[model samples]
Target: MEAKQLNIGDNVKKFRELKGFTREQMADYLNLSVSAYGNIERNKTDLTVSRIQQIAEILEVDLAQTLNFDASQVFNITHNEVIQGMHSKVENHNHPDEYKEKYIKMMENEIARLKKLAGEA
Candidate 1:
């Protein structure tokens, strides 16, 4: 089965609504036209990494929280091994515990990077 595409823009919009910020308010904060901000929330325009971080801060959310990265994508993963005739192919060699550790490490590193960027801004 194919994994469904997750839109980061939707997540950002949801968090914005949760924070009670209207499009106009957010656009004003970002110094962008309402149309531009609307496009972003609607996933019409590509947003830069810094812009995403700014939005996350505006909504008082962690950048990682806004991103919602999955273990499979962030870390190399395989579900199982495939046996075809005499040939065997390993899907993912990492154990569940290993994935967990990598997940935690990745999250921590990302959070730290964002914090550093925020400090510089």
Candidate 2:
């Protein structure tokens, strides 16, 4: 069986959504136009290593994790499972509920810190 190709843009989009960030927020943070930022998520732009690192920092994930993101590792099987006997296997790497709670708390704290910085500016 051929290995599935990983899409970095899709990975970025998923991570961004998980962190409760809007495209506009990310664009503002990166000082890019919204359309320019959208190009990254849409894979229209060829990303550099530095760009990937910057995105990883914004997503609060390690660069390696961002590159290796597997949706099945995080998403609940029941929610994404296909009906009609087409089995979609999801391997649980971390306890989804616990992991999500911790991640959400971290993101919330980060958001507050950014807001404070924005206010001070």
Candidate 3:
């Protein structure tokens, strides 16, 4: 199987959406124009570590998580099982559902926390 490529821009976009932040809000917070912020999400900008750190801080996510976010693993939990020819994937394994639920809950909590922080700020 080919290794999946990680895209920091995509991850940043995901986190921003999860936090219920609009592009305008993010751009304003970063003192950037909307088009400039859009470039970041489109992977048109070559991001530096400092920029990545700034984005992570703004999104309220850990730098490591932002750098390492894998959409396939998170969204396609049965990928490995399918590759192995396991036809009874969902029925045979409840892990995916549990994991997805937990992940959703975690994101929800994070969103709430960010909202509270924003209110405070």
Candidate 4:
């Protein structure tokens, strides 16, 4: 399905509703007076970068998603699950026994150095 096009007010309102926040509640969270925040949601004011960041955090969205309102683009650019899975697989590789031994030894040495530096050796 084609993603719905959302303007700034649409994004703001959608996210607020998704989070179950009314304009007054969201304004309280933003430390803005209700009228000021209402202006933002009504598209009468531009969102500053800091405000956008704050709204993204409040909406539990990424900065890009708040600014662009492109849900697909947001997911594509910021998906962490795939990357984390790949990293986990690589870290658990059943490599040559010799390689595993070397990796362990390296880690041990690093830990020993850290302990010594911290006077905890």
Note the Cα lDDT for every prediction shown: 0.64, 0.67, 0.67, 0.61
Q: Which residue pairs overlap in candidate 1's backbone?
A: 78-92
- Full candidate order by TM-score, most accurate first: 2, 3, 1, 4
Candidate 1 ranges beyond 4 A from true positions: 1-4, 69-121
Residue 41 lDDT, candidate 1, scale 0-100: 79
Cα-based lDDT at residue 42, candidate 1: 82
- Count of backbone clashes, every candidate in sequence: 1, 0, 0, 0
Clashing residue pairs for model 4: none
Tell me the lDDT of candidate 3.
0.67
lDDT for predicted candidate 1 compared with the true structure: 0.64
Pairs in clash, predicted candidate 3: none
Model 1 C-alpha RMSD to native: 17.3
Q: State candidate 3's TM-score.
A: 0.55
Residues 1-121, model 4: lDDT tens digits:
9986546776777556434456876776777899999888888887778888877766667877776655343222211121221222111223344434544565587679989999998
The better-scoring model by lDDT among 2 and 4 is 2
> What TM-score would every model get versus the actual structure?
0.52, 0.55, 0.55, 0.51
